[model samples]
Target: GAGVSQSPSNKVTEKGKDVELRCDPISGHTALYWYRQRLGQGLEFLIYFQGNSAPDKSGLPSDRFSAERTGESVSTLTIQRTQQEDSAVYLCASSRDSYTGELFFGEGSRLTVL
Candidate 1:
């Protein structure tokens, strides 16, 4: 895909279950980011990866949320022991580099915890 692509556009999981969301960024983009948007809320940064640099994970809401990116390609966000508050739209985005500011976003993966 020419733009960022995310899988499992919609997910419904029971509380305490684990969920994994995937994202494939543009072929040449060197920076990838993960964000979360809860109902009626703004986008909240979760993680960022740039080249081989250490990812910035300061925005992760809790220890149960983790993400990994392989090189400049695919990235995955995992939620362990999911809770109701974890329900939200997980958005993935990518750019030419960390400074580009212009991000190409995916359609997003919507998670619903019951």
Candidate 2:
């Protein structure tokens, strides 16, 4: 895809199970970010990866949540031992980062834990 694409736009999983969501960012972008939105709340930054720099995982909710990105390209988010409260929309965005703050976002991967 030319823009960011996320798999399984909607997912349903039982609590205590695990799920993996995927994302493909635009070509040539140097910055990629992951965020989680809980219901009506604003998007919360989860992690970010750029070039050869180290990833920032400070926003991860707990050990149950983790993500990875390969050089501003494809990325995956894994939620382990998911809980009902883990349900939310996972968003991915990428940008060229040439002194701009704009980030292109995917439709988002919606997960519902039952």
Candidate 3:
């Protein structure tokens, strides 16, 4: 029963570059979600996928961001043309249901745009 996990824990990059963050969710969980938390702000839902159902990408910030999930297991978030405003902690969570409070979050992938 592995929990959600993320890579690099921290990332520092220059503006206008591209970055890809990875996430590994718990096994047997059909619901996965991606969220972003900027400084002094709340978590913003980016994308969510449940089983073979249609994936929800409504919360993505701009055309520069995208995500994908495979077999309800792993997910990756990509940011193209990174801006300073994109600097924040990209968090991944998964639960049995989106409305459930049992969602678990990884340590988060922290990105710094300079």
Model 3: pairs clashing at backbone N, Cα or C within 3 Å? none
What is candidate 1's lDDT per residue for 6-114, written digit by digit as tens? 9999999999999999999999999999999998899999989896354578899899998888877899999999999999999999999989699999999999999
Tell me the tens digit of each residue's lDDT in model 2 across 1-114.
788899879999999999999988888888888899999999999988785353578999999988877765788899999999889999988888735788999999999999
> Which portions of model 1 miss their true places by more than 4 Å?
none
Q: Provide the global lDDT of candidate 2 against the true structure.
A: 0.87
| Per-residue C-alpha lDDT of model 3 across residues 1-114, encoded as one tens digit per residue | 478999879999999999999988888788888899998799998988886354667899899998877777778899999999999999998897766669988989999999
TM-scores for all predictions: 0.96, 0.92, 0.91
Q: So what's the TM-score on candidate 3?
A: 0.91
Give me candidate 1's TM-score against the actual structure: 0.96
Task: Tell me, by lDDT, which candidate is best.
Answer: 1
Comparing 1 and 3 on TM-score, the stronger one: 1
Winning model by TM-score: 1
lDDT agreement with native, every candidate:
0.92, 0.87, 0.87
lDDT of 1: 0.92
What's the TM for model 2? 0.92
Off by over 4 Å in 2: none
